[model samples]
Target: MNQHRKPRAQSAFTQRAVRVGLFAAGAAGIAGAVPAQAATGLPQHSAIAVDQTFSRADFVHHTQARDSFTVRQFGTVNAATARNQANAVGVGCSVDDHCRSVALSFQIVTMAGEHTHLNAINRGDAVNEHCDGCQTLAGAYQFVVSTPRPFTLDKGSQQKLADIHRRLDALTRSTLPATDLKTRADALAAEVNKVLADAVAKAPKGAERPTVTLHRHLDGWPAH
Candidate 1:
């Protein structure tokens, strides 16, 4: 009985040794067979760049490089254009024969301005949360333009309505005075800066693409 037990013990030991050796060999083979491209610092897809200011003066996309980057920018061009329509409205309203025409310009401008301004703010908000032109996170504005524009306010025919309209109309106009357009512009610039955050991706980190840059140049506005 003792001899039979000894042989069984030796057989079990031999089996354990074979299993350990096989496991070691498999691990070594896997380690040695790793893709050489990954081992030598090469990425799968190339890199592209998109650089531009408020309006894209020049935008270029790049690929394959030692120190390469893809820069994306955002600007409120369409909303701004819609907001600027106020100037045409102002001129048209002033010339129209109807009394309500001229008065309506203020409302139109204010409402449009409010809408446009809101849109800009919304875009910025999207960037902060989503890190892109459109909202990436749960709560974000895809795009918005809220400008303050008043409605038709002509008093001679409708005295009560006109009086009430005047008081409420003030709300539609920008609180910023004529002396402060520049200040307001500065504020907008700052807000824009806040929205446009820089995205840095090393060789393997930034393929997801933080943001996409686009452009629409205004006719009169200076190129940002």
Candidate 2:
């Protein structure tokens, strides 16, 4: 009876050892499969709560803490067809190994300019750009060219611009998903298209129609 009992005890101990060994191997496999960052308890990508709720004070605080860039290309070009070109006019700034929000405002204001071409472009990857991973929070470009040459902006065009301005203001203040922001941006571009078309139609014949091309590119959003 003693011999049978000893053999049974040894068998149970062997089974337990096997189970422990299997568990250890499984744990090792799982650890090996994990990424290097995970192994080091570091996150590869930080999360951005696009649709998170925050107060106006919080928005102002974040905006003030980050970098801001404003540019105005104002003046009249006497030439019938004047051209103004700016590349990477305004950009954002990074901080604390992460990106911060930035505000970029660009305006082209002139009085009575005929056949002017305004090009304002902000490419995120400029050679001297400092905002490597910065996000654009508020951005706008106002192109106002008033001419006394019998060219008037119709009410419809004015309304479109107003609507775009309102939407842009809301976007600057609200927290929205990237996709949603992109949709709104596309809509704004569409409105701009209509305004341009209207301008062409209203311009007198044999005159160089004033043209303005504004391009703004920001991180986490499509180019506008």
Candidate 3:
């Protein structure tokens, strides 16, 4: 009877150890699914450094808190067919390491001389829509051209942009609102898209449509 009881106790201990090992393995897998920054012992909130350039105009936008960020670009236009370029940069951290990436977007908004005709060129990747570790970032570009003209946006694009703008505008005016970084970033994206869509809609129709292009040098950034 003693020998039998001792064997039973040994078997129970072994089973308990196996169960513990399985639980640890499961916990590790869950951690692996999370962002590296969160897995590593890093502060939940830290200052994020941001910089942006639009059509050769340079600006810096940063936030000490990880809640939100905004960037605005404004410049003067003097040429008949002017080209615009913009890029936004930010740094993201993992558990023990950090990497820098940039978001790039561009569009051409112009008006013909002596004519009320407006023209714009829209490229697909006109904005950065994805940043792995970035909670939220917002940006805008407003150029003080010689004279601005009215432009029409595609029905689909126009409606989408308008919706986004309206939502953002409402949020901006709210006295007290509750939301997260992802929501704010999404609202900001709508504002940017509306600007571009409006430019495309108002773009003058002619055989000599100017060319618009976007050149990006960063990885893991999505086009809008």
Q: Largest TM-score belongs to which candidate?
A: 2
What do the candidate models score in CA lDDT, each in turn? 0.17, 0.32, 0.26
Report clash pairs, candidate 3: 118-204, 119-203, 119-204, 151-202, 152-201, 152-202, 153-201
For residues 117-177, could you state the per-residue lDDT of candidate 2 as single tens digits? 3222222221113433333333333333433243445577667666666665566445654
Name the candidate, 2 or 3, with the larger lDDT value: 2
How do the predictions measure up, each by TM-score? 0.19, 0.41, 0.25
lDDT of 1 at 26: 9
Residue 30 C-alpha lDDT in model 3 = 12
Q: What ranking of all candidate models by lDDT puts the best one first?
A: 2, 3, 1
Tens-digit lDDT string for candidate 1 (104-205):
111111111111211111111001111111101101111111112212212332354243335333422334322242233333333332333221111112
- The residue ranges of model 3 lying beyond 4 angstroms of the native Cα positions read 1-108, 113-157, 162-224
TM-score of 3: 0.25
- Indicate which candidate wins on lDDT: 2
**Clashes found in each candidate (C-alpha, N, C closer than 3 A):** 22, 0, 7
**Candidate 3's residue-wise lDDT over 1-224, tens digit each?**
10000010100111112101101010000111111111111212211112232211111232111111222111112222212222233333332332222222222232222222212211111122222332222222222111222233346655664565456545533332113422464446545544554554455554333222221121122221
* Worst lDDT 10-window in candidate 3: 2-11
In angstroms, give how far residue 118 of model 3 lies from its true place. Answer: 15
